[model samples]
Target: MVAPSPYQIVKKLKVSRVLVFRTAQRYRRLGTSDDMQRRGRPVTVTTPEAVKAVREKIRRNPARSMRKMAKEYKMSQGSIRTIVKDKLKMIPYHGSHLTTLFIDEKIFTVEANKNGQNDRIIATDYQSACEKGKILNKTSHPASVMVFAGITADGKTPLIFVDPGVKGVALGQFSLRKPIMDLPARRRPRSSRQRDSRVVSRQFSEFISAVDWPASSPDLNPMDYAVWIYLTEKVSSKNYPSIKALKTALIKKWDEIDDDHLRAVIDAYPKRLKAAIKAKGGRFENYS
Candidate 1:
């Protein structure tokens, strides 16, 4: 019987056209779908024992360099890498520009959250507001607004507009109790901050509890990665006449983000942890 064409096979199996074509071509030439065995020397260094040793060494100290692992295991660096990647399913990661100390702190936070010690994590940050218009002359500073916002697993809170020239005191006036109280007691919701601003230290100390977030690690914050970026992009796309206009745009955009997208961003926390581990506590480019 004549073999079916690649298109026919793709329609029948619902597989990719390229995959089906390759398989059909192989079958016609070799009379089988399996690949023809290639002639080459068998791999001897990547034995079961070597794979186990590599895994153990990584488990003991994930920070060990690949070159060091190669020397310790008495194998070529390429072999060690292959064993770690192909067999052990490990990826070498380096922390972002943040120092090793900050990376360690982030890893601990991620692990603690994963283990359910802190069930709810909210990310909060301040965006330096900017004015859009032509700069006709030099030394003219653009009028800006300081916008504060927070995001949780469920969604974002209302935009907190900070008054001009007021710094940490703004947080003191802004109420965080409503958001915290809304969560169940069992969740033990906690917020994260990069620094102990006066408001956080004085006011937050009195009522709200927050975790010490890594200052340099914006990737760990959904506010930085998801909400702020999205909001800034939307706000910047159109020109606003005054700070009030910008504030209105900010609130509208914040409200427009649906729950589904917010939940997706929150759900990515575990994947981010895995990416961090794979990168060996380094900065990861892609979380999704």
Candidate 2:
């Protein structure tokens, strides 16, 4: 194939004039535009020793800032960031700066929730996983485990498995307390709509009657709109043999989730609320 001229390359790539000139100059001198070493001070700051030091510091305190580490090590924040991110493959999650804690409950059954798109399976041509009996069927009554959890910008709470047939009055005994200052916003779909409404109403009837909460505002709840769906997708990839197995998998995956993701979910709250307002608090899921 004929190599494109510099003008053609510039037009096709739409790169800056300076970059095109530099590439052309390099190619003329070295017969290749690929990276070539230039004479400069060798990078000694992000050495193996520095990387090990940074990794240990982060392990001790994941919430430590690059600025603080840089000041302590007498290195630039840029170098610290590079060591933390490129060298260690770690995401810089914002610390416990935000105080709001979003909490919710979800039930996991032995049979995964296989609805519409989630039911589709990948397989050979004209021979899908469904044909091989990989798909799970819906059950009228499946063994289930209900989990209660909370998340903030910092991290998540330990998964609390609710006992079978536990009522709202009994839920208070779980002692949902964390050391962090939090404005707890609990959104319980099952208990709110079906079973525990009466019990919950009896306990806080004034609060229920006084506040005109949106009747169907899942978009307003972070857990309802994001966290639960994410967890369900991760946990329900296959049918669990028993509730015990499902709970174990849930715990494993839940703990594996990093604070970066939790922080991002919390950060999107304002945008979701704005979209909700634009939709007049009705079916805002499709707004953005």
- Model 1 per-residue lDDT tens digits across residues 54-140: 888888988989999889878899999899899988888867322111100100000111212433333342222112212122223
Q: Quick one: how many clashes does candidate 1 have?
A: 7
Query: How much is 2 displaced in model 1, in angstroms?
Result: 99
- Model 1 deviation from native, Cα RMSD in Å: 20.7
- Reference-based lDDT, each prediction: 0.61, 0.74
Q: Please give each candidate's TM-score.
A: 0.41, 0.52
Residue-by-residue lDDT tens digits, candidate 2, 6-74: 788889999987899898898888999896786899878999999999899988988888899999999
Q: How does model 1 fare in lDDT?
A: 0.61
Q: How far is candidate 2 from the true structure (C-alpha RMSD, Å)?
A: 24.5
All predictions: root-mean-square deviation over Cα? 20.7, 24.5
Best by TM-score: 2
Clash-forming residue pairs, model 2: none
